[model samples]
Target: MKPLRKIIFPAAGLGTRFLPATKASPKEMLTIVDKPLIQYGVEEAIAAGMGEIIMVTGRGKRAIEDHFDISAELEANLKSAGKSALYKEVSRVARMAEVIYLRQKEALGLGHAVLCARHWVSDEPFGVSLADELIIHEKPAMQQLREVYDQTGCSVIGLIQVPASEVSKYGIVDYTTEEGGLLRLTDMVEKPGMDEAPSDMAMVGRYIFTPRLMQLLKAVQPGKGGEIQLTDAIAVLAKEEPVYGVLLEGQRFDAGNPEGFLLANAVIGLQHAEYGESLRKSLQEYL
Candidate 1:
């Protein structure tokens, strides 16, 4: 098995939930505390030992590119102002990794976005991270899945046990067996009804997929809303080969929506070293 040195970030969605804010900006560029959501995802991938970033972006997402690029003029200004700390931080972001951009060209779906990266990811197992789903943990969530892929030489997806009432909101996993805390997935169902859900282990957005999955994704037909679904390809992959799901030990925030986005800001804000105490005091006074 090849080392997982590359990861794909699907950032093509229009972010309809954010309304006017997203109307002019990419949702992945929205800040949680001080860092944009996509930066956190990129940092997580780097911490996991992945050095190459393949971003599947679309129109109106130029800010995402600019964020990772070096701003020579801004850096010079910061240096002249004696803001060395801020200057170094900005320079660090530009050198984070070799980020390659690919245009999805359409608001197709997650599968289509991943498919757009096939040329760059050719013949190598790659990781996929949805920036909107932020997973906070001591160990990078992508690294956790990569460890499983290292052991089994198969695909691994991050899982979070959701409540029964929320099973309809995610792709629930059907497993044949559980060993050492990893579920051997037999199949996956997208947003199944309460009674039809196979398990509470909902698939989170982090995934380490074998190159075979790329082929599977190519054959996937468009599902609901005429969009190709990644879950559909994963379901087929489960039947053909071993695919595992590991319950991620972390706090996950679905920053794709307003409620979760606000909660993430508050929760992560309270954990920020520089502003935690002051923010905590302010929250107490406001509440």
Candidate 2:
């Protein structure tokens, strides 16, 4: 409630799935097309009227900080080259919002990453977005969850129906009732097995949680991977308060892995206004 001014981004992962590329650079910095994966999430949050950005980072993630900071040299060089449009775009990114970075110190888990921002959030409802999950929609995904949070005055997590075989890969939700795209969650389990899975509706990376959820996260012990799981905390929250699962309407890309990353680039690239036509023609010829 309190107008959802702050959102947290958990960008501390080592990104081992990307191998040598991620060895030096962060997986979040991997570009979808022209912009980095993280930038898309930041732009979406800004579009949803959340101006305060709390980035939870870890060791070897200074690039994430520098990416969002003002670059005087780059801007000056672009201006001198008479690239006014490019200069404005770079300048706009730096001035997008008030960004606050918190070092996670260790690779705990999503729950721990979000818990690190509790002090900054300070008793207000906030949002959590995993940068690797690239969602393309007419209405920003965060805005959609915010709308639900506003109406229910409760925590809301974005949901997507995955295949039964892939259910073990995500936190599956069991709903007590459904109204159109919205479901009132009864229970949720993290990475449940196919046979034990409550439902095929899996939790995505978008979340708008109440301050109380922070308290619940603190109480959660490490689950399967010895990491404090956010789903574990959300399950407790559901038991005490009303938690809603919203089936997000969008094109989602799990750009954390190589295949997904390449797919995201190709798909999103073909939709870019200036480059889409050229890229489409190029792909057609190549194929």
Candidate 3:
């Protein structure tokens, strides 16, 4: 298949889970250690060799746009003051990729949010990474998926095995093994109970999808909670084109929930260069 050259990020969620803190800022803008959640995703896409970064953003999400834009005033101030490190950090963001934003006016589901970026991506295959799912692997998650997409010429989604008891929290896929560690998806059940789940393979962030997904999204009538889900759309697409699930070889953190956020913060915080040593020295005390 042709190289997957674009990545679409769906950032239109209200971030109701983070509430008061997110009232002013999008939840994806919440910082992990230093950079915001969305920046981690941007870095992942850049690492995967993506060209255009199209964001399906919503209203009041200007800060997300500003984060990637070249801040001339900020750069000049830093330069005049000899803050080279700070200036370089700010400048690197603008060079990540050609970032283009599309406003998803409604708080529609993930499928609809992705549909908003169709105009920018046209008929090209693209990658999609959730701004909230923080994959903390040394190897960027999207890069891993990109390799599979490049090799297989099939749509791929990152997977992580959740605990049997926690399977109900995500979209679970039932698949038949087609090759080593790769699955040919048979079906998808959203939030199925632990006992009802096909396997512990929970579909998480990071996806490489074809343009056919747009047509599938349009075909699927709204399902759970009256919104279109990307999982459902993909499942339908699987019936035709080949769709595979790659169990992402990494640690992933979901910052959408309080406990997950704290856990993710603690894990990533300990790895920060400025804080690694201190964090390791003191982590046990908190535990």
lDDT of each: 0.94, 0.92, 0.86
1-287: candidate 2 lDDT, tens digit per residue: 47789999999999999999999899899888899999999999999989899999988889988999999999999999999999999999988989999999978889999999999998999999998988999999999998889888999999999999999899999997766556889899889899999999999999999999999988999998899999999999999999998889989999988998999999989899989999999888879
User: Residue 63 of model 2: what lDDT?
Assistant: 91
For candidate 3, lDDT tens digit of each residue in 1-287? 66678998999888888889889999889988788999988888888898689988888799999999999999999999999999998999867779998998987788898888877777889999897888877788988887788878889888888889899899999888875766888788888987899888889978999888977887877888898888899888888988988888777788878778888888888877899889888977878
Clashing pairs in 1: none
- What does the lDDT come to for candidate 3? 0.86
lDDT of 1 by residue, 1-287 (tens): 78789999999999998998999999999999999999999999999999899999999999999999999999999999999999999999998899999999988889999999999999999999999999999998998988888889999999999999999999899886665766799989988999999988899899999999999999999996799999999999998999998889889999999999999999999999999999999989989
Candidate 3 residue pairs that clash: none
**Model 3 regions lying over 4 Å from their true place:** 280-287
Model 3: per-residue Cα lDDT at residue 173: 92
Please tell me which model should have the higher lDDT, number 2 or number 3.
Answer: 2
Q: In candidate 3, what residue range of length 10 has the lowest lDDT sum?
A: 178-187
Q: How many clashes in each structure?
A: 0, 0, 0
Query: Could you estimate the TM-score for every candidate?
Result: 0.98, 0.97, 0.95
Better TM-score candidate (1, 2): 1
Lowest-lDDT window of 10 residues in candidate 1?
174-183
